[model samples]
Target: MPAFDPCYTLIVLAGGQGSRMGGCDKGMLTLGQQTFAELLVHRLRCSAAAFNPGYGPVLISANRNQQDYGRIGAQVCADLRPDFQGPLAGLEAALSRASPDLPAVIVPCDMPLLPDNLPAGLLRSVMADQRSVAVLHDGHRRQHLCLALWPQSALFSIRQRLDENQRSVAGWLAGQLVADVTFSEESVGALPFACNINRTSDLAQLPG
Candidate 1:
Protein backbone atom coordinates (compact mmCIF):
# COMPACT_ATOMS: atom_id res chain seq x y z
CA MET A 1 0.00 0.00 0.00
CA PRO A 2 1.43 3.30 -1.08
CA ALA A 3 1.30 6.36 1.10
CA PHE A 4 -1.74 8.61 0.80
CA ASP A 5 -3.37 11.20 3.04
CA PRO A 6 -1.99 11.11 6.59
CA CYS A 7 -5.05 12.09 8.59
CA TYR A 8 -5.90 8.88 10.45
CA THR A 9 -5.94 7.97 14.14
CA LEU A 10 -5.13 4.54 15.52
CA ILE A 11 -7.39 3.59 18.44
CA VAL A 12 -6.19 0.71 20.57
CA LEU A 13 -8.91 -0.94 22.71
CA ALA A 14 -7.38 -2.01 26.04
CA GLY A 15 -10.31 -1.74 28.42
CA GLY A 16 -11.41 -5.35 28.81
CA GLN A 17 -11.26 -7.04 32.24
CA GLY A 18 -9.90 -10.33 30.79
CA SER A 19 -12.36 -12.52 32.63
CA ARG A 20 -11.16 -15.60 30.74
CA MET A 21 -7.56 -14.94 31.76
CA GLY A 22 -8.43 -15.33 35.42
CA GLY A 23 -9.47 -11.69 35.71
CA CYS A 24 -6.01 -10.39 34.91
CA ASP A 25 -5.66 -7.40 32.61
CA LYS A 26 -4.75 -8.98 29.26
CA GLY A 27 -3.08 -5.83 28.06
CA MET A 28 -0.75 -5.74 31.02
CA LEU A 29 -0.18 -9.49 31.07
CA THR A 30 3.26 -10.74 30.15
CA LEU A 31 3.49 -12.34 26.73
CA GLY A 32 7.14 -13.20 27.31
CA GLN A 33 8.88 -10.66 29.54
CA GLN A 34 7.29 -7.45 28.27
CA THR A 35 3.65 -6.58 28.84
CA PHE A 36 1.40 -7.23 25.85
CA ALA A 37 0.01 -3.69 25.90
CA GLU A 38 3.46 -2.17 25.90
CA LEU A 39 4.54 -4.34 22.99
CA LEU A 40 1.43 -3.40 21.02
CA VAL A 41 1.90 0.29 21.64
CA HIS A 42 5.53 0.09 20.61
CA ARG A 43 4.80 -1.75 17.38
CA LEU A 44 1.90 0.55 16.53
CA ARG A 45 3.99 3.64 17.09
CA CYS A 46 6.73 2.25 14.89
CA SER A 47 4.24 1.26 12.19
CA ALA A 48 2.58 4.66 12.26
CA ALA A 49 5.89 6.42 11.88
CA ALA A 50 6.93 4.09 9.07
CA PHE A 51 3.74 3.76 7.06
CA ASN A 52 1.43 6.60 8.09
CA PRO A 53 3.75 9.40 9.09
CA GLY A 54 1.87 12.52 10.19
CA TYR A 55 -1.17 10.42 11.07
CA GLY A 56 -3.59 12.40 13.20
CA PRO A 57 -2.91 10.65 16.55
CA VAL A 58 -3.02 7.37 18.46
CA LEU A 59 -5.61 6.93 21.21
CA ILE A 60 -6.21 4.17 23.72
CA SER A 61 -9.57 3.39 25.37
CA ALA A 62 -8.65 2.19 28.82
CA ASN A 63 -10.70 1.53 31.95
CA ARG A 64 -9.47 0.95 35.53
CA ASN A 65 -5.80 0.61 34.65
CA GLN A 66 -5.67 3.79 32.58
CA GLN A 67 -2.53 4.98 34.34
CA ASP A 68 -0.78 1.69 33.59
CA TYR A 69 -1.02 2.44 29.86
CA GLY A 70 -0.73 6.23 30.05
CA ARG A 71 3.05 5.83 30.07
CA ILE A 72 2.83 4.82 26.41
CA GLY A 73 2.00 8.43 25.50
CA ALA A 74 -1.21 7.80 23.56
CA GLN A 75 -4.40 9.54 24.64
CA VAL A 76 -6.22 7.29 27.11
CA CYS A 77 -9.98 7.46 27.77
CA ALA A 78 -12.43 5.74 30.09
CA ASP A 79 -15.38 3.82 28.70
CA LEU A 80 -18.31 6.09 27.91
CA ARG A 81 -20.99 3.46 28.39
CA PRO A 82 -22.04 2.47 31.90
CA ASP A 83 -21.04 -1.18 31.63
CA PHE A 84 -18.33 -2.87 29.63
CA GLN A 85 -20.54 -3.05 26.55
CA GLY A 86 -17.75 -4.44 24.34
CA PRO A 87 -15.13 -3.35 21.83
CA LEU A 88 -17.73 -1.51 19.77
CA ALA A 89 -18.62 0.68 22.70
CA GLY A 90 -14.94 1.46 23.19
CA LEU A 91 -14.65 2.41 19.53
CA GLU A 92 -17.78 4.54 19.78
CA ALA A 93 -16.38 6.36 22.79
CA ALA A 94 -13.07 6.91 21.07
CA LEU A 95 -14.78 8.08 17.90
CA SER A 96 -16.78 10.59 19.83
CA ARG A 97 -13.52 12.09 21.07
CA ALA A 98 -11.93 12.23 17.62
CA SER A 99 -12.10 15.01 15.10
CA PRO A 100 -15.05 14.59 12.75
CA ASP A 101 -12.89 14.97 9.66
CA LEU A 102 -10.25 12.50 10.74
CA PRO A 103 -10.53 8.76 10.10
CA ALA A 104 -9.62 6.12 12.72
CA VAL A 105 -7.89 2.76 12.57
CA ILE A 106 -8.75 0.52 15.53
CA VAL A 107 -7.29 -2.70 16.90
CA PRO A 108 -7.57 -4.73 20.08
CA CYS A 109 -4.78 -4.94 22.66
CA ASP A 110 -5.00 -8.72 22.88
CA MET A 111 -3.79 -9.12 19.32
CA PRO A 112 -0.08 -9.21 20.03
CA LEU A 113 0.91 -10.21 16.51
CA LEU A 114 -1.08 -7.67 14.55
CA PRO A 115 0.38 -7.25 11.08
CA ASP A 116 2.86 -4.42 10.70
CA ASN A 117 1.26 -3.50 7.39
CA LEU A 118 -2.29 -3.60 8.71
CA PRO A 119 -2.74 0.15 9.08
CA ALA A 120 -1.71 0.85 5.50
CA GLY A 121 -3.85 -1.94 4.12
CA LEU A 122 -6.92 -0.75 6.01
CA LEU A 123 -6.39 2.77 4.80
CA ARG A 124 -6.03 1.59 1.21
CA SER A 125 -9.18 -0.48 1.42
CA VAL A 126 -11.26 2.31 2.99
CA MET A 127 -9.95 4.87 0.55
CA ALA A 128 -11.25 2.70 -2.27
CA ASP A 129 -14.73 3.84 -1.27
CA GLN A 130 -15.39 6.86 0.85
CA ARG A 131 -18.48 5.30 2.41
CA SER A 132 -16.94 1.91 3.00
CA VAL A 133 -15.44 0.55 6.23
CA ALA A 134 -12.18 -1.27 5.64
CA VAL A 135 -11.41 -4.48 7.52
CA LEU A 136 -8.87 -7.28 7.66
CA HIS A 137 -9.57 -10.83 6.45
CA ASP A 138 -7.54 -13.97 7.07
CA GLY A 139 -8.74 -15.38 3.70
CA HIS A 140 -11.39 -17.82 5.03
CA ARG A 141 -13.28 -15.50 7.41
CA ARG A 142 -13.30 -11.77 7.70
CA GLN A 143 -11.45 -10.60 10.77
CA HIS A 144 -14.20 -8.01 10.60
CA LEU A 145 -13.84 -6.31 13.93
CA CYS A 146 -10.18 -6.87 14.59
CA LEU A 147 -8.61 -4.13 12.55
CA ALA A 148 -10.75 -1.42 10.94
CA LEU A 149 -10.67 2.07 9.52
CA TRP A 150 -13.79 4.00 10.38
CA PRO A 151 -14.83 7.52 9.56
CA GLN A 152 -15.95 9.75 12.39
CA SER A 153 -19.13 10.42 10.43
CA ALA A 154 -20.41 6.96 11.39
CA LEU A 155 -20.48 7.83 15.08
CA PHE A 156 -24.17 8.77 15.14
CA SER A 157 -25.32 5.50 13.60
CA ILE A 158 -22.96 3.54 15.85
CA ARG A 159 -24.36 5.26 18.94
CA GLN A 160 -27.89 4.57 17.72
CA ARG A 161 -27.14 0.87 17.30
CA LEU A 162 -25.63 0.78 20.77
CA ASP A 163 -28.72 2.46 22.20
CA GLU A 164 -30.78 -0.28 20.59
CA ASN A 165 -28.71 -2.81 22.54
CA GLN A 166 -26.84 -4.07 19.52
CA ARG A 167 -23.29 -5.02 20.51
CA SER A 168 -22.19 -7.10 17.55
CA VAL A 169 -19.23 -5.52 15.76
CA ALA A 170 -19.75 -7.55 12.59
CA GLY A 171 -23.48 -6.83 12.71
CA TRP A 172 -22.95 -3.09 12.99
CA LEU A 173 -20.33 -3.21 10.25
CA ALA A 174 -22.70 -5.11 7.97
CA GLY A 175 -25.06 -2.12 7.89
CA GLN A 176 -22.36 -0.06 6.26
CA LEU A 177 -20.42 -0.18 3.03
CA VAL A 178 -17.70 -2.66 4.01
CA ALA A 179 -14.65 -4.05 2.23
CA ASP A 180 -12.32 -6.89 3.18
CA VAL A 181 -8.60 -6.84 2.53
CA THR A 182 -6.95 -10.21 2.72
CA PHE A 183 -3.61 -10.74 4.44
CA SER A 184 -1.65 -13.75 3.31
CA GLU A 185 -1.17 -16.36 6.01
CA GLU A 186 2.35 -16.89 4.67
CA SER A 187 3.17 -13.26 5.21
CA VAL A 188 2.20 -13.46 8.86
CA GLY A 189 3.67 -16.97 9.32
CA ALA A 190 2.93 -18.73 12.64
CA LEU A 191 2.10 -15.48 14.35
CA PRO A 192 -1.65 -15.16 14.08
CA PHE A 193 -2.74 -11.57 14.11
CA ALA A 194 -6.31 -12.59 14.87
CA CYS A 195 -5.36 -14.95 17.65
CA ASN A 196 -6.59 -13.18 20.78
CA ILE A 197 -5.14 -14.27 24.14
CA ASN A 198 -8.29 -14.70 26.19
CA ARG A 199 -7.56 -17.68 28.43
CA THR A 200 -4.57 -19.40 30.00
CA SER A 201 -4.91 -22.21 27.47
CA ASP A 202 -4.90 -19.63 24.70
CA LEU A 203 -1.49 -18.45 25.85
CA ALA A 204 -0.05 -21.88 25.11
CA GLN A 205 -0.92 -21.36 21.46
CA LEU A 206 1.40 -18.44 21.20
CA PRO A 207 4.78 -19.04 19.60
CA GLY A 208 7.29 -19.76 22.34
Candidate 2:
Protein backbone atom coordinates (compact mmCIF):
# COMPACT_ATOMS: atom_id res chain seq x y z
CA MET A 1 0.00 0.00 0.00
CA PRO A 2 1.16 3.51 -0.71
CA ALA A 3 1.91 5.76 2.25
CA PHE A 4 -1.33 7.28 3.50
CA ASP A 5 -1.88 10.68 1.97
CA PRO A 6 -2.87 13.24 4.55
CA CYS A 7 -3.99 15.77 1.97
CA TYR A 8 -7.18 13.95 1.06
CA THR A 9 -10.17 16.23 1.68
CA LEU A 10 -13.66 15.11 2.71
CA ILE A 11 -16.62 16.96 1.21
CA VAL A 12 -19.98 16.27 2.85
CA LEU A 13 -22.73 17.13 0.36
CA ALA A 14 -25.68 18.79 2.09
CA GLY A 15 -26.62 21.43 -0.43
CA GLY A 16 -29.71 19.85 -1.95
CA GLN A 17 -33.13 21.58 -1.82
CA GLY A 18 -34.62 18.61 0.01
CA SER A 19 -37.73 18.65 -2.16
CA ARG A 20 -38.65 15.14 -1.07
CA MET A 21 -38.56 15.79 2.68
CA GLY A 22 -41.18 18.54 2.47
CA GLY A 23 -38.54 21.10 1.58
CA CYS A 24 -36.63 20.64 4.83
CA ASP A 25 -32.85 20.53 4.89
CA LYS A 26 -32.10 16.81 4.93
CA GLY A 27 -28.77 17.34 6.60
CA MET A 28 -30.51 18.87 9.62
CA LEU A 29 -32.96 16.00 9.96
CA THR A 30 -32.43 13.86 13.04
CA LEU A 31 -31.24 10.30 12.55
CA GLY A 32 -31.91 9.04 16.05
CA GLN A 33 -30.02 11.41 18.39
CA GLN A 34 -27.85 13.14 15.85
CA THR A 35 -28.54 15.20 12.72
CA PHE A 36 -27.44 13.75 9.39
CA ALA A 37 -24.49 16.11 9.07
CA GLU A 38 -23.43 15.45 12.65
CA LEU A 39 -23.59 11.71 12.11
CA LEU A 40 -21.47 11.93 8.96
CA VAL A 41 -18.79 13.97 10.72
CA HIS A 42 -18.47 11.45 13.51
CA ARG A 43 -18.36 8.51 11.10
CA LEU A 44 -16.01 10.12 8.59
CA ARG A 45 -13.52 11.01 11.28
CA CYS A 46 -13.29 7.37 12.24
CA SER A 47 -12.90 6.31 8.59
CA ALA A 48 -10.17 8.85 7.91
CA ALA A 49 -8.29 7.94 11.06
CA ALA A 50 -8.13 4.30 10.05
CA PHE A 51 -6.44 5.39 6.82
CA ASN A 52 -4.07 8.03 8.19
CA PRO A 53 -3.25 10.11 11.22
CA GLY A 54 -3.84 13.53 9.62
CA TYR A 55 -6.23 14.13 6.72
CA GLY A 56 -7.38 17.37 5.24
CA PRO A 57 -10.31 19.33 6.65
CA VAL A 58 -13.98 18.41 6.13
CA LEU A 59 -16.01 20.71 3.90
CA ILE A 60 -19.80 20.72 4.14
CA SER A 61 -21.54 21.78 0.93
CA ALA A 62 -24.76 23.45 1.97
CA ASN A 63 -27.00 26.07 0.45
CA ARG A 64 -29.26 26.89 3.39
CA ASN A 65 -28.56 26.65 7.12
CA GLN A 66 -24.95 27.57 6.58
CA GLN A 67 -24.41 28.65 10.16
CA ASP A 68 -26.11 25.56 11.55
CA TYR A 69 -24.03 23.27 9.35
CA GLY A 70 -20.90 25.13 10.40
CA ARG A 71 -21.76 24.27 14.02
CA ILE A 72 -21.16 20.63 13.09
CA GLY A 73 -17.41 21.48 13.32
CA ALA A 74 -16.65 21.65 9.60
CA GLN A 75 -15.89 24.42 7.19
CA VAL A 76 -19.07 25.25 5.24
CA CYS A 77 -19.24 26.25 1.58
CA ALA A 78 -22.20 27.18 -0.62
CA ASP A 79 -22.74 26.46 -4.27
CA LEU A 80 -21.33 28.85 -6.85
CA ARG A 81 -24.88 29.78 -7.83
CA PRO A 82 -27.74 30.00 -5.31
CA ASP A 83 -30.45 28.18 -7.32
CA PHE A 84 -29.72 24.77 -5.77
CA GLN A 85 -28.26 23.30 -8.94
CA GLY A 86 -27.80 19.92 -7.28
CA PRO A 87 -24.99 17.91 -5.67
CA LEU A 88 -22.70 18.46 -8.59
CA ALA A 89 -22.77 22.18 -8.04
CA GLY A 90 -21.96 21.69 -4.39
CA LEU A 91 -19.16 19.34 -5.36
CA GLU A 92 -17.74 21.97 -7.64
CA ALA A 93 -17.80 24.58 -4.89
CA ALA A 94 -16.10 22.28 -2.42
CA LEU A 95 -13.45 21.34 -4.96
CA SER A 96 -12.64 24.96 -5.62
CA ARG A 97 -11.97 25.53 -1.93
CA ALA A 98 -9.80 22.39 -1.58
CA SER A 99 -6.20 21.98 -2.66
CA PRO A 100 -6.07 21.39 -6.40
CA ASP A 101 -3.33 18.75 -6.31
CA LEU A 102 -4.85 16.28 -3.87
CA PRO A 103 -7.87 13.98 -4.01
CA ALA A 104 -11.24 14.58 -2.29
CA VAL A 105 -13.86 12.17 -1.05
CA ILE A 106 -17.42 13.31 -1.81
CA VAL A 107 -20.35 11.91 0.10
CA PRO A 108 -23.94 12.71 0.82
CA CYS A 109 -24.86 13.78 4.35
CA ASP A 110 -27.84 11.40 4.40
CA MET A 111 -25.67 8.24 4.23
CA PRO A 112 -24.14 8.39 7.68
CA LEU A 113 -23.41 4.69 7.96
CA LEU A 114 -20.60 4.77 5.39
CA PRO A 115 -18.00 2.05 5.88
CA ASP A 116 -15.07 2.85 8.17
CA ASN A 117 -12.62 1.80 5.48
CA LEU A 118 -14.08 4.17 2.86
CA PRO A 119 -11.21 6.62 2.63
CA ALA A 120 -8.58 3.93 2.47
CA GLY A 121 -10.59 1.83 0.06
CA LEU A 122 -11.19 4.66 -2.38
CA LEU A 123 -7.56 5.81 -2.24
CA ARG A 124 -6.26 2.33 -2.85
CA SER A 125 -8.28 1.94 -6.03
CA VAL A 126 -7.36 5.40 -7.20
CA MET A 127 -3.63 4.74 -6.81
CA ALA A 128 -3.70 1.21 -8.15
CA ASP A 129 -5.76 2.04 -11.22
CA GLN A 130 -4.37 5.54 -11.68
CA ARG A 131 -7.83 6.83 -12.43
CA SER A 132 -9.09 10.32 -11.73
CA VAL A 133 -12.23 9.03 -10.03
CA ALA A 134 -13.30 6.00 -7.98
CA VAL A 135 -16.58 5.08 -6.24
CA LEU A 136 -17.96 2.27 -4.14
CA HIS A 137 -20.08 -0.44 -5.74
CA ASP A 138 -22.46 -2.43 -3.54
CA GLY A 139 -22.14 -5.65 -5.59
CA HIS A 140 -25.33 -4.66 -7.42
CA ARG A 141 -25.09 -0.95 -8.22
CA ARG A 142 -22.69 1.97 -7.98
CA GLN A 143 -22.92 3.87 -4.72
CA HIS A 144 -22.03 7.13 -6.41
CA LEU A 145 -23.00 9.48 -3.63
CA CYS A 146 -22.25 7.34 -0.61
CA LEU A 147 -18.54 7.36 -1.51
CA ALA A 148 -16.71 8.89 -4.47
CA LEU A 149 -13.19 10.29 -4.72
CA TRP A 150 -11.48 12.28 -7.43
CA PRO A 151 -8.35 14.26 -7.87
CA GLN A 152 -8.93 18.00 -8.01
CA SER A 153 -7.65 17.88 -11.56
CA ALA A 154 -11.14 16.75 -12.61
CA LEU A 155 -12.57 20.03 -11.40
CA PHE A 156 -12.35 21.31 -14.95
CA SER A 157 -14.57 18.52 -16.25
CA ILE A 158 -17.14 19.23 -13.56
CA ARG A 159 -17.15 22.91 -14.44
CA GLN A 160 -17.65 22.13 -18.10
CA ARG A 161 -20.56 19.86 -17.30
CA LEU A 162 -22.23 22.52 -15.20
CA ASP A 163 -21.71 25.09 -17.89
CA GLU A 164 -23.62 22.86 -20.27
CA ASN A 165 -26.49 22.55 -17.74
CA GLN A 166 -25.81 18.83 -17.43
CA ARG A 167 -26.49 18.03 -13.78
CA SER A 168 -26.66 14.26 -13.86
CA VAL A 169 -23.86 12.80 -11.74
CA ALA A 170 -24.07 9.44 -13.45
CA GLY A 171 -23.76 11.15 -16.79
CA TRP A 172 -20.67 12.96 -15.59
CA LEU A 173 -19.10 9.80 -14.22
CA ALA A 174 -19.88 7.93 -17.40
CA GLY A 175 -17.78 10.44 -19.31
CA GLN A 176 -14.74 9.83 -17.17
CA LEU A 177 -12.41 6.92 -16.57
CA VAL A 178 -13.76 5.61 -13.26
CA ALA A 179 -12.75 2.71 -11.05
CA ASP A 180 -15.40 0.77 -9.19
CA VAL A 181 -14.35 -0.30 -5.71
CA THR A 182 -16.63 -3.12 -4.70
CA PHE A 183 -17.35 -3.77 -1.01
CA SER A 184 -18.52 -7.22 -0.09
CA GLU A 185 -21.49 -7.75 2.24
CA GLU A 186 -19.17 -9.07 4.95
CA SER A 187 -16.91 -6.05 4.72
CA VAL A 188 -19.64 -3.41 5.01
CA GLY A 189 -22.04 -5.54 7.08
CA ALA A 190 -25.32 -7.21 6.02
CA LEU A 191 -26.98 -3.84 5.54
CA PRO A 192 -25.27 -1.69 2.97
CA PHE A 193 -23.92 1.53 4.45
CA ALA A 194 -24.40 3.28 1.09
CA CYS A 195 -28.15 3.42 1.74
CA ASN A 196 -29.44 6.98 1.93
CA ILE A 197 -32.44 8.61 3.57
CA ASN A 198 -34.30 10.44 0.83
CA ARG A 199 -37.87 10.66 2.10
CA THR A 200 -39.71 10.75 5.43
CA SER A 201 -40.88 7.20 4.80
CA ASP A 202 -37.24 6.20 4.49
CA LEU A 203 -36.63 7.37 8.04
CA ALA A 204 -38.84 4.61 9.42
CA GLN A 205 -36.53 2.11 7.69
CA LEU A 206 -33.28 3.45 9.16
CA PRO A 207 -31.20 0.85 10.93
CA GLY A 208 -31.04 1.35 14.63
lDDT of 1: 0.74
Worst 10 residues of 1 by lDDT: 45-54
Superposed by TM-score, candidate 1 places the C-alpha of residue 169 at a distance from the truth, in angstroms, of: 0.8
lDDT of 1 by residue, 10-71 (tens): 78888877888777777787767777777776665534455554555777888868887887
Taking all chains together, each candidate's TM-score versus the true structure is 0.87, 0.87
Please, what is the whole-model Cα lDDT of each candidate in the order they appear?
Answer: 0.74, 0.77
Error at 87, model 2, angstroms = 0.8
Per-residue lDDT, model 2, residue 19, is 87
Residue 49 in candidate 1, Cα distance off native in Å? 4.9
Cα-lDDT of candidate 2: 0.77
CA displacement after TM-score superposition, residue 62 of candidate 2 (Å): 0.1
Stretches > 4 Å off in candidate 1: 1-5, 46-55, 187-191
